[model samples]
Target: MLIFTSVTWLDLCLASAAVYLVKQLSGKKNPAPYPPGPPGWPLVGNIADIPHNKAWLTLAKWGKKYGDILHVKVPGRHIIVLNSVKAAMELLDKKSSIYSDRPVFAMGGELVGWKDGLAFLSYGDRFRYYRKNIHRVIGSRTAVNVYEPSEEIEVRRFLKRVFAQPEQLDAHIRHTAGAIILRISYGYEVKDNNDPFVDLVGRAMHQFSQANDPSAFMVNIMPWLANVPEWFPGAGFKSLAREWRQTLKETVDAPYKFAKDQIGAGIAPMSYISNLLKGRTLSAEEDHMVKWSALSLYAGGADTTVSTIYSIFLAMTLYPDVQKKAQAEIDAVVGTDRLPSFADRDSLPYIEALVKESLRWNVVAPTGIVHCVSEDDIYDGYYIPKGSMIMPNIWSMLNDPQTYANPSQFNPERFLDNDGRGPEREPRTISFGFGRRICPGMSTHRSIHLADASIWISAVMSLAVFDISKIVENGVEQTPEVDFSSGLVRRTLSHPEPFKCSIKPRSAKAIELIQQDVNY
Candidate 1:
C-alpha cells in the first residue's frame, strides 16, 4: 500500500507539470512588447535594487539610463514606468479605458479593506460610482465654493500662529491644513494640534505610510505567503497587517460615527460626512464605502497640503531672490495692510508662479497611485501587456531638462510667461496624477496654496530675517536647500538638522492686522 501511494503522488505531480506546460503553450502571446530595463535576476527580479525611500527618484534615474519607457519585474509583478510626458499621456490618458485599473495588493486590498478605497480600487462599477461622487462633491466648481471660507479662516489662523511662535511654523502649518480638512469632512475643528483627532490621523498616516513602504511586506513580492496563519511563529507581517487594519478602521470610522451621532441628534454641521449621511441608511457595505471616502479626504488632504507648504517655505529660504520677487509682486498687488485672499489671485501673477513652481519642484505624489492596464495596448511601437502596472514617473517629467532649463533650480519663472501670466492650458507636472485618477482635490488644493502663499509672503517682509544661516554646526548653514527627507513625499528641502530662527513683526500695521484677523 505504501509503494502504491508513493507512485500515485509522483504521477499527480507529473500531471500537474504537464498541465501547466500545456496552459502556457495555449496562452496568447503578449500583443505589444514590453520596454527594456536592467537585467533582472530570476524570481526576485529587480526588487533587490529598489530602496525603501526615494524609489521614484531611483526609477527616474533608471528611466534615463534605459530610455523613456522601462519595464521592471518584481517577483510576480510587471511594472512599466513612463518617464516622459508623451508616454504617460499615451498610456494613462489617451488609452485610459485600458489603463485605469489599479494593481491588486493582498495586504492593501483584502487585509486592510482598501479594495473599496477610491485611490486603490480597481476600474469597475464601484470605482466609477466613487469617482463620480467625489467629483460631485470636491470637483472644480464645488472645490472653489468649498475652499473660499476655509482658505480665508485658515490663512488668517496660520498667520497668527506664525506671528505667535515662528519657530513652530512647521507644526502650525500642518495643524492649519489638517484643521481645514477635518472641518470640511467631519465638522470637527482641530482647535489644538494635540487634539485626539489630530494625533489619531497623524498616527494613522504614519501607519499607512509604513505599511505601504516597499519593504514592509514580502507578500508584495510573493503573495502566496499572505495566506500564512497569524498563529504561526514566523508570521511577523500578519501581526503588523492586523495592527494596520485596526488603525485604519479607527481613523476612518471614528469621524464617521461622530458625524452619524451628530446627525441623529439634529446637531450636525454642514460637512462632507454630514452631507453623505443625510437621508442615507448605512448598509454594511455603504458604511465601509463612506468611511473610506472620508478617510481619503482626511489623509490625502492633510499630508499633501502640509508637504507643499513646507516646500514653499523651503523654496523661499533657499532662493532669496525668488522670495523677494514674489514678495514684491504681493506687495504691489495686495499690499501689506491686510492679508491676501483668493479674489486677489489673478492680480498676483508671480505668487501663482511660485505656487506652481513649488508643486513642480518636488511633487508630493511623485510616483502617484500605480496604474494597471485593463487590456493589452501599444504605444510608440512598444507593447504594454494587460495586467501590467504603469507608473507615470512625475519626478522625471518635472525634472526633464528639455522642458525646464536648470530643472533642479526652484525658479517659479519657468511656469510663467514673459508677461507674467501662468502657463497656458498645457500639461504641467503630474502632481495631482494622470487621467481618471487625477486628484479630486485639485481646485481646492490650488486655491488654498495660492491664497496661503500670497498671505505668507505679503504678511512677512523677509524670510531672510528668520534665516537660521547664522546658527550652524560644522560650517553648514541651516537652510531649506540642505533639508529634505526621502520617499515619494519628501519633507522640507535642505532643512538644517536643528537650528533656531527669530520671527519679528515686519511692521506694527502687519501685527495689528494679524491680531484682528485672528479673531475674524
Candidate 2:
C-alpha cells in the first residue's frame, strides 16, 4: 500500500480530462448535420441563448431563421423544437414509438413524484396502462358526451358564482373547473368555500408551475445536484421536494379514498374511478393505475378547461362586437328563455367557432409536452440524436402567420372565414396540446374532446346572460392587457395575469336565470 501511487494529483486530473475529451469527441461526430440554430458557446452550450420566461416567442423567432426543425444544445442535453405541425405530426405522432418517451424533470418528475402521473410517465407499459385507463373513460367524443349533463349543471353554477362575485372571475373559473373535475373523477362534490380537494389541486398545480420555474430550484438547472444527499451542504431542495412530494401524493390519494368509500357504501355515482372500481376486484397493478388515471383527470386535465374558459371572457371583453355576434347567434338559435345546453352546440356555429378562437388565442400548454427520442435518427437530413428533448412549440405552430391570417387577432371568423378552404385548420388538433398537462412532457394529447363541451357551454351561457365589458374605474374605462403572469417567471399554463372586466347580466330575465338553482 505504501508503494502504491505513482500517479500525482495533476496526472489523475489529466487522466479524467482525457476520458472526458474522448467522450466529447465521440459524441460530437454526428451522422448528419444538426438542424440550424443560434450557435451555442463551446462550454455552456446555449445556456444564455434560451429565455426562461416566454421562451416560446424566442424559439418561434429562431424557427424563421432555422427552418421548422431547430436544434439547441444546453450543458448536458440537446433540445429540438418542432415549429410546424407537419414536423411535429411527422415525428411525435407518426414515429411515436421512438418519439413518445419522456425526459424526467429533476424536480417535478422525479423528486416530487409527478413522474408517476401520466403526464411524466415514460413510454412503456405503465404509460400504456395509464392511457388505456383514461381512454375507457373520456377518450372519444361519444365517451366525453356522457359527461354533458354534468358539464351544463356545473357551468350553470359557474354562472351563479360569476353573477355573485364578478370581481373574482378567475377564482370562480378555477372553482367551477375543480367542481366539474371532482364530480367526474371521484363522485365527490366540492364545498363552495374552502373545499379541501379543490385546495389540494390548487396547491399541486401551483407546485407544478413552481417546478417549471428554473429559479425555484437549482436542481432544475444542474440536475446532477439531485444526487446530493439530504444531509449534504445546502441541499435544502431535498426537504422542499419531500414536502411537495407529500402534497402530490395527497392530491393523488385523498380524492381516490373518497371515491372508494363511496363505492363501498354502494352510493357512488358513475365516474371515471367508480366505473373502474365498481363490482370488480382489481389487481394491485389495476388499482395503482386506477388511482393515477383518476388523477390524470383531476390534477392533469382539471386546468384544461380553466385556461380555455378564460379565453372566452377575455375574447368577449376585448372584442365586444365579436361578443355581440356570438350572443346574437346563441339568441337566434337557442333563444333567451332557457340556458343553452350541448344539444344547441351543433346549431350554434358562431359559438362553436368562438371555442376554437379561445383555444387558439391563448395556447393552454404553449411550450407543449416534451417528448424524448429513444434512438438516433436523421430527420429531413438533420441528425436527431437519442435522448434529445423534442418540444412541439404549440404556440409557434398555432401563431404561425402563414397558417393563421392575422395571427395576433382574436377573431373566431378565422375558422369561419376560410373562403371555402375548408374552415382553416382545426385548432383542436393543436390547442388541446400535443401531450398531457401541468408542465409539458412527452405524453399523449389530453385532447380537445374533453374541453370542447365545457368551453362552448361556458361561452354560450356567459354571452347569453352576461355582458363582459372593460372595467371602469373613476369614470374611466380601463382595458385589461392580454398578458399572463407578468412574464417575470416561468409558467406552465397561460393563465391571465389578474385582470378585471365588468360582468353584468344582459337583462332581468338573464339575472333570473343566473340566480335559478341548478339541478344535478
Candidate 3:
C-alpha cells in the first residue's frame, strides 16, 4: 500500500536535499580520522545501513571489522557507536564534562514533549535539579532500603497474581512494578486490578517507545517533517505525534495532580513528591521540577524492572539447572517456611549472582540513551566532532567474549569467583551506563541501580515460592525463546516477545507463603 501516495513528491524532495547535504559534508577536509564504520551510500549516508530491529547486532558486527568505535552518518545526523566498555568509559566516562548532554530527540522530545522528563532533559540547571530530586529520594543503598517493605509487599502480590493466572505472567509483572513505583513516587496505592494510573502509564509508555524509535517515524531523522500540518498529505506521523504528546502530557500531569490533591486533603501517604511537597511552598518552576522528577522515578523504575524480572522467569524456564541451583541456595539459606527478604540478600550468594546474571543476560536498554557531545575533541587519533551522537552499545559490552567466557550462555557461576579464576566484571557497572551521563540518573550515582534492590527482592521472593518450567502443549514441552526486544528508552525493559512458561508454587507450603497478607 502506498500509504503516502499524496506525499511521494515531498519525500523525494527531502531525499534529494539529504543526498546533496551528505555529499557536501563528506567532501570536507578533517584534521584527523573519524572511527571506521561501514561505508554509507553516496547520497543518504548510512541510512540504508541502519537496521530497524536488533540494531546492536549490526553495530557489533561493524565493530568486528571497524574497531571498537564506528562512525556513521545518516541524513542530517552523525553517530558514533562504541562497541566496547573500555571505549565507552574512556570517552563517555573519563570525558564526562563534555559528554553528558542528551540529544534533542525530534519525535519524542520536540513533538511529544518528553524532553522535560529527566531521561531526555538536556545537561543544564533543570537536569541537575531533576537529578538532585531523584537522588535525594533514592540516591543511596540506605535511601533505597527505605522502600524494601514496599518492594517485598508488591513482589508477594506478584507471586499471588502469577499463581492465580500464570498465562498472564507479563501483565502481572507490569502491574507489580507500576504498583511499587506509583506508591513510592506519589504515595498513591494502585487498585488490585484495572488501576487507572497504571493503565495510563502503560499507554503513555508505549507511545514513548514508539515516539523515540528513529526508524518508526521519519520526523525523528528529519525534524522539519514535524512541521507538516496534520491535514497535509501523508502527515499521519504528525497526527500520531500529537495524540502521543497528549498521552505524555497526561502521564506527566495526572499523577502529579493526584499527589498534590492527596496532600491537600491531609490524607497523603509519604511518597517522593509528598516528601518534597508536604510542607513546602514552591515556585512554579520548583513545582514543575518536583512533578516531572516524580514521574521520572515512575518512568525509570516501573518499566525496566518489568523487563529485568521477567527475564529472570524466562531464565528459570529455559535453564532448569541454574534455577535449581539458585533455588537450592534459597532453601538452604532462607528455608521454605518463609519467602526471602532483603535481610537475606548477603546470605544468598548464588541468588545474588543469579540477579547479576539476569541483568547481564537480558540487556535492558541495550543501546542506551544517546549522549550528545557538548564540544569537539580528538581521542585515539580520531576527530570526534561536537554534536556527534554517541551510542553506548551496552548489549555488546555485556556479551563481549573478551569480557565474559561463553557470553551467550546463561550461567550465573560466571559471576562467582571459582577454581582460582576471579568472577567476570560485574554487569551493573556496564548495564546502568557510563560517566556523568550514566543512569545514576536522578542523582550522579544511581541510574538503574535505583531498581537493584527492587529486582533482588522480586527475584528472591518469587524464587522462594515459585517453580517455573517450560509449558507443555499436547504433552510436548515447549521451550520459551530467549528474545528481548528494544525500542527507545521507555521500552527499555519491555517483556520478552512471545514469552511462554509455567509458573507454579513449588509446594503447598510455597502456596501458603505466596498467599500471605501483602500489606506492608
Q: Which ranking of candidates, highest lDDT first? A: 3, 2, 1
Model 1's number of clashes is 9
lDDT of 3 by residue, 185-288 (tens): 99888999899999998888778877776656666766777787888876787777789888888888998899899999998876888888988999999988
RMSD of each: 6.5, 5.7, 2.5
TM-score order, best first, reads 3, 2, 1
For residues 73-93, write the lDDT of model 2, one tens digit per residue.
Answer: 865578999999999888876
TM-score of each: 0.85, 0.92, 0.94
Off by over 4 Å in 3: 1-5, 9-28, 441-448, 487-495
lDDT of every predicted structure (CA atoms): 0.66, 0.79, 0.82
> Global lDDT for candidate 2?
0.79
Q: Point out the higher-scoring one by lDDT: 1 or 3.
A: 3
Query: lDDT tens digits, residues 195-262, model 1?
Result: 88888888877766555544455555446657878775445667778887888778887877888888
Clashing pairs for predicted structure model 1, backbone only? 32-383, 33-383, 480-493, 480-494, 481-494, 482-494, 483-493, 483-494, 483-495
The alpha-carbon lDDT assigned to residue 97 of candidate 3 equals: 90
> Largest lDDT belongs to which candidate?
3
**Candidates 1 and 2 compared by TM-score, better number:** 2
Q: 2 or 3: which has the higher TM-score?
A: 3
